[model samples]
Target: MDDLVLLRREFDAEEGTFLGGLRPDLVWDKAAFSRLEQAMRRVCAAFAGRDELPRWLVEGFWFCADWVPSWTGHADFPRPEPLEYYEGAVERLRDLQSWFVTGESPYLEHHEWPAI
Candidate 1:
């Protein structure tokens, strides 16, 4: 299967949406997160050489990658608040694309996670 197809399957659009700021229907477990991460990585690798990437792909990948760790940190299972927790993932993805194309990594702040 195509990497993009795999990623899209892993990140089901209907399930990804929040209902009244919560996603109770989705499985928020380690196995689910691991599968998402793997699918995202495969998509990233497949698109590394491309001049442009799909916006949904970048946004979905970053939404999970950036928020999952913080969501896991909460003792009482709190839903991830996008307004409060959103890191600039699109920009980071752009930097990653540049690095793949130019073989140069940009300087990152200590707390910033690399897009790849």
Candidate 2:
């Protein structure tokens, strides 16, 4: 499947509002957040084990992570807040994309690693 198509399937219009367009005051309801988190997890899983991801996928994940911190809470996993997971996902995707670009096994910088 195409990367953009996969991203679109994970993050649909009805799921959660786009982070790039989200306002600071906007509060997604429980269901909306559930949809968003589910999609994020699915996207993450889809990209797992890949040495490199497409540029579009990295951009999409970055866009979603941009607004994760604004959410109130989640219904599914909660180890890394929604925003945190998305942010890390973006870095992971970027590492993969970088691998494609530079032919390196380890692409992430020290700062790119998620803080524990």
lDDT of each: 0.47, 0.46
- Among the numbered candidates, top TM-score falls to 1
- Which portions of model 1 show Cα errors greater than 4 Å? 13-22, 25-27, 78-116
TM-score of every candidate? 0.48, 0.41
Model 2: C-alpha RMSD to truth? Answer: 8.9
> What TM-score, to 2 decimals, does candidate 1 have?
0.48
**How would you encode candidate 1's per-residue C-alpha lDDT over 1-116 as one tens digit per residue?**
56566567554544542211224543344344434444554455556557676777666555554454455445666535453332343344344445434334455323445322
As a TM-score, model 2 comes out at: 0.41
Write down the RMSD of all candidates, one decimal each. Answer: 8.1, 8.9
The candidate that wins on lDDT is 1
